[model samples]
Each structure stands twice: as C-alpha cells, then as structure tokens.
Target: MREVAIIGAGMTKFGRSDLSLIEIMSEAAIRALEDAALGDQKVDSVYVANMGAARLNRQTAIASALVDQLNLFPAMAEAVENGPASGASAFKNGFQAIASGMADVVLVTGGERMREVNNLEATDFVASMSHPQAEYIYGVTLPALAGMFTRLYMDRYGVTAKHLALVAIKNHANALKNPYAHIHQAITIEGILTAPEAVVNNPYIADPLRLYDCCPVSDGAAALVLTTREIAEKLGKPIVKVGGIGQATDTHAVHERPDPTELTAVKIAAQKAFQMAGIGPQDIDVAELHDAFTILEIAESEEAGFFPKGEGHNALEQGVTSLGGKLPINPSGGLKAKGHPVGATGVAQLVELTWQLRGAAGDRQVEGAKNAFACNFGGFGNNVVTTVLMREE
Candidate 1:
C-alpha cells in the first residue's frame, strides 16, 4: 500500500443556496482544482457523495452530469451514499484509489441542497435514513431518537440540559470567527438557558430537545483532491497525510440495540483507526467530532475516548474541549454552528482538520496542532466513519 495525502481542499459556505446541486458542486470542485494548482486534466476520476438529490431535487445519475459539466469526459465518475457518512466513505474510496496504485489522483466531493424543501417535507426526507419497519414507519425523526437517547444519557450519567446548552453556546462562539459557518451569531450561556421561553422561543422539537440543539437544514458542498505523498511534496502544498481510516455499522433500528448509550460501532471504529495510526486519544492535538446535535458532540467525544465514560460533560464544563483548552474540538463551529448538510458534513469535517493541521485556520486555529481526528456518525450512531489525520513530516 502507498501513503495518501490531501493535496487540496475547498468548500462553499454551508447555508441556503439558490443554486442547483450541480452548480454548487462545480463551485467547490473548481476551487479545489485551483487550490491544488492542478488542471482538470490531472484528475483521474471523481467520486461524489450526496444522499438527497433523488427525493429533494428530483435528480439522479448526478455523477455523469457532474463529469460532463466539468468537461472531464474521459474520467470515471460515480456517487457514494451511506446516509450522512457518504462524504467520508467517498473520501475513503479516493484514498484507496491512490493507496492501491490504481489511480494517481481523484476528486471527492459531497454536496446537498437540503434547505430547498419545506420543514415537513424535509423531516420526512431525513426520516428515510431510519429503519423502514421499526423507525421510519413509527414516525421516529432523527431528533426524536436523539431526544430519547439524550434522556437516557441524562438519566444514567446526570448529563443536564444546561450541559447540552453549553455545547451549543461554545460552538456558536466558535462559529463567530468562521466566515463559512452557517450560524455565526453568538449566544451566551444565559441565552441558551432561557432559549425555551423566549419570544421566538426555541420550540421543543422533541422532548428535552429544543430547536437550538438541533443542526439546521443546510445546502453546501466540500471537495478534496487526493494523491500520493511524493506528488503532494512536489506540488509544494501543505502536507496532511491520511494516517488511518475505519468504518463500522450497527443495527439501523434503534430498538434492536441493547444499549443506546454504547454506540458500539463508534468504539470499534475508533479503536481500529487509533491502532492503525499508532496513536492514542492523548496524541491528538485537535479534533472534529460529529455534532449534528449538541448531545452528539458529547456522546461522540466520550465514545471516541477523548474523555472517560460519563465524563464528557464534565470535560466540557472544565474547558477541556474548548479551542485553547487541552483538546480543541470542532473549531470549524461544527455541525452545530457550521450547519449540517448531511452528506457534505463528513468531508467538511476533514476540510476543517486539514486547515487546522496545516496551521491555516486563521481566527479559529488551534495552536501547535500536529495530529487531528474526526468522527462522522450516521443514522443515530448506527454507522460511523473515523479518520485519523497527521501533519506530514
């Protein structure tokens, strides 16, 4: 196997977009090619990750359209969808293409225009990710399941709504410095505490879960160019190596799991990645955990071994997960503030980590970041993709 390196990365601001999905993707793909200083001719293939075009945009076979639009007529193009982890899965394919010597360079992009649909329609669309018989048929939206798991977390570990609110405030503050973040407005600890009762009250989206705690529907795209390490150094771009990658899946039906808190797949995937990277949680200088919901950041952090069992909330309260703290998590404002355009989120996490590892994250940069980890969870912890990235020496 060969070492894979990220030669370039680019993304459009994650928010409501008037442009069609292909248009948004072209913007990102072109930016990536420019950033890599590589012409379209250098791209050997393209892998797209998008979960909603068929239902939301009335589109399919998007890969062929993308290749033609970009005039990459001779290059192979395909799409990958694994619920929300589609982006990371696409990246994994690109990485393997380079590592296996099958392709010298590949372009991986994930884009979604979720906000185009109304709230009710959007809710039904997202619910498709759940099990047809057990979850979707019973009308269990993502937030409703998250609320149930959150209630379990709160009851067993004493995690409070205030703790979850703190996660929201922290991420929003981080978003303030991120020009590309979806929700850049800052909210105070007090603001979140009183959010449930305010004039434009953060309505109860689900029991114990307010609107503020959930990631907004968004439209966005992210792209990355992958090649062998030697090629990257020759190009004189900042070096970020793909040290390790691991993925795992659990029962999609939430009820089938004996323990909702475990997220067995997360632990297994993290362990595989850490082992492959030859590092531990302590070796990671910065991190980007999946924060589709505030509680998810906490749950993923704990499951990823950043904190002890039932201690992730305490770690947050003590500032262990803050930007300047022990391990800076989600300096990109996370899905909480940066927005969660489902399919785009997994690759977007890598974009942030790449920026941080290269010391290029201007205002939100973590000091002395050398190694970073990202976890992209899918379908309420039913599936996950973990990547360990390091600054190439």
Candidate 2:
C-alpha cells in the first residue's frame, strides 16, 4: 500500500447550528479544501458520514447534494452510516482509496443535524440503533445502556462515583479551552457530586449515570483532505501520515457478550490499528477516546491498551489522562463536553489529533506529540474504528 498523508482539517463549531446539514457540511468541506491549498488539483472522491439525517433532518442523498453544492461535478460521492462511528468509518474508506492507489485526493466529511429534533425525539432516534427485536422494542436508549454498563463496570472494577465525576470535571475543563466545543461550562466534583444538594444539580439520567456524565446532542460537521505523500509535500506543510486504520464489530446485543464490561470491539480494533501503525499504546503521545458517557472514557482507555483491564479508573486518578499527564486523552474535550454530533464525532477526533501533531492545538496542545490514537465507538461498542497518526518533523 502507498503512504497517505493528511494535509487539511476543518469543522463547524459543534452545537445547535442555525444552518442546514448541507450548509454545515459545505462550510467544513470548503474550509478543508482551502486549507489544503490544492492549487489546481481536482478532488477524486467525496465521502460524507452521517447517522441521523434522514430521520432527524428530513434529508437524504446528502452526498449527492454536497457535490452539487460545491460544484464539484464529475467527482464520485457517497454517504456512509455506521451508527456513531460513521465518521471514522467514512474516514477509513477515504484512507483505503488513497492507500490502494485508487485515488489521489479524497475528501471525507462527517456531519449530523441531530439537534433539529426535540430531546425525546432525538433519544428515540438514537435508540433505533439498538437491536430491533431484543433491545429497541423495549425502547433501550444509549444512556440506559451506558448506565447499566457503568453500574456493572463499577462493581467489577471497584470504581467509585468520584471517579466518574473526575472524568466529567476534567473533560468539561478541557472544553473551555476549545473554541469549537459545544459546552463551555467548567464542572467540579464539589458542584456536581459532593455538595449537599448536588443530587438536584446532577440528577440521575439512568441510575448511576447523572446528567453531567452524558454528552449533549449536537449539530456539526468535520472534514479532512487526504492525499498521497507527494501531494502533502507539494502543499508545503508539516507531514502527518495516516499511519493506520482498523475496525471491528461485536454482538449486536450487549447481553450476548461473555463480558459486558469488556469492550471487545474496541480491543480488537485498536490492536489491529497499532499493528498496522507499527506502534503500541505506550508510544502514543496523545489520544482521543469516545467519551459520549464519562464511564466510557474509563472503559475505552483499558480496552485500547492504555491501561490494564479493570484498572482504567486508577490511571485517571493518577492524572495519566490529563492534558499535562503522561498520555493526554481528549484534549479537545471529547464527546463528554465537546459534543457528539453522531457522524461528525469520529472525524472530529482525528481533526484534534492532527492539530495536536502539528502543534496547532493552542492551549490544549500536547507538548512534543508525535504519535496519536483515536477510538470511535459505535452502537454501544458493538462497532468500533480506530486510527493512528504519526507526525514527521
């Protein structure tokens, strides 16, 4: 396979967007192309990742509309949906197109207009991803699944409510530094968990999981321009290679797994990604985990090989995942506070890692970051996609 490099990354601020889905995507796609400074190079293919546009936004055939919106006729375009991991899955498609010598320049963009619907409607729409016969019929929402998982993991790993709150506090603080993040509020354990009336402030969304622990529904789009190494060199920018991409799936129903606490798909996909990158978790200078729920941050860290099984919360307690710590995770706030716009999140994680590798992540920049990892979890960890990037200085 030929080497591929990322030359440009762009995204709309993740929140309730006044623009339509296509407009939001156009803004991100155009910004990415402009950042690439492609000169006269024609885009070979365009891929859009979105999970809920058809139901939430009353729109379909988004990729076709996107091409026309940008006047990029004659270029191939398609839509990809893989639950919440749609963005990374679409990114993987673009990466393969370049690596397999099929295309020279591919544009991968992921976006969703989920906030267009009310909270209840949005919840129902997301719940549609559950196993239809075994789970969705009972109206199993993602938060409910996450809550059960959190409860089980806590019991097995001896994780405390304090540990979960720490994740919220850290990610919320990180979001304050991210200009494009949706939630700008900084949370504290005392305010959300320890105070006398904290219960009222952070009511339980699902048993053990509180309001602050869950990511808010958002609307946004993120884009990246991928090309051969030669194109990146010609563009005159710092080199950031797309080192590896891997994906895996688990049982559609959580109960079917031998161990619900173990994120089997995350472990398998991350291992494959590392093998392809010729690197290990310890070599990662920075990382971005899917933290749509706070406990997910803890669980995914272990599954991704950043920590031992059943010991991820210990690492969080030791500050191992902080911005100034040994392996900073989610410096862009992650989905916890950065907001999860369904399909846009997977692509956004890469955007942050790319910025960190390039030393462009202003205040949240991981010092001397060279190797980066990202885990995009989809459909309650039933599907996952992992990506690794290396910076060539």
How high is each candidate's TM-score?
A: 0.97, 0.99
* Residue 166 accuracy (lDDT) in model 1: 86
* Candidate 1 lDDT, 124-158, residue by residue in tens: 88889999988888889999999998999999999
By summed lDDT, the worst window of 10 consecutive residues in model 1 runs over 194-203
Q: Pick the candidate with the highest TM-score.
A: 2
Q: Which segments of model 1 are wrong by more than 4 Å?
A: 39-41
Q: Across residues 205-238, which tens digit of lDDT does each residue of candidate 2 receive?
A: 9989999999999999999999999888987967
lDDT of each: 0.88, 0.94
Backbone clash pairs for candidate 1 read none
